[model samples]
Target: MTSRFTELVVDCHDPEGLADFWCRVLDFKVIDRGEGKVEIGSWVPTVEEVRARQMPPTLLFLQVPEGKTVRKNRLHLDVSPVDRSTQDEVTRLLGLGATTADVGQDPDASWVVMADPEGNEFCVLRTLAPQE
Candidate 1:
């Protein structure tokens, strides 16, 4: 038996705004939208079609009243560039409302730590090698 990772839920102050930021960052589209939540992921498989095949986990942004504290997150995401250089992708993410984040990482760290508009931390790693 195997388990699949289907969704990553993010708590945010503004679900719609966060969803917009991530859509641009991931080149993803909004798959489902509701009063206080939005789901973004690949556009190929409609939400209803997701069960038919394996797919990357979708991001679900849910509205929350409390703001993020300065404490380090228990969990964070690390992303790698698929086609562009890491620096370029970091710049693009910055232009899309992400900001540099300091999380006690060593100055020589290879990945760039960044935070979304709502202050959720994620990392941009070096471009990954092509799969064989």
Candidate 2:
């Protein structure tokens, strides 16, 4: 049998806060909440609905006692716009507490690097062209 990617767990100081920020960024909703953890994914009214649809992997935020100390993240997420321009999305994300990040990328790079409120690094890529 082949393996399928299911979820990505993020270690954060505040699961609720991180989940809230990510939900807004990804247009997702909270799927589950447990002690010190929160799971957010594509907005589905119920688990049954989620099961019925082919959904992307969910993000789980787990509360941790220690804060992030790494200057650069070993693994980061790259987001592409669905219905908006990359600049517009970057502005929107900045309004939501994401700060501009410089990761030694070239000045002409097509993607913008940003950091979330808790200093986790992520990138916003240029939107894909329409398929014929």
Instruction: Compose the digit string of candidate 1's lDDT tens values, residues 1-132.
Output: 345578899988899999999988888999999999999988645555565666788999999888887667888889898978889889999999999999899999999999998888999998884645
lDDT of 2 by residue, 74-103 (tens): 999999988788898999999999999987
Off by over 4 Å in 1: 1-3, 43-53, 129-132
Question: Backbone clashes per model, in order?
Answer: 0, 0
- Per-candidate Cα RMSD to the true structure, in Å, reads 3.0, 3.2
Q: What does candidate 1 score on TM?
A: 0.86
lDDT of 1 at 110: 96
Score every model by TM-score: 0.86, 0.86
lDDT of each: 0.87, 0.88
lDDT of 2: 0.88
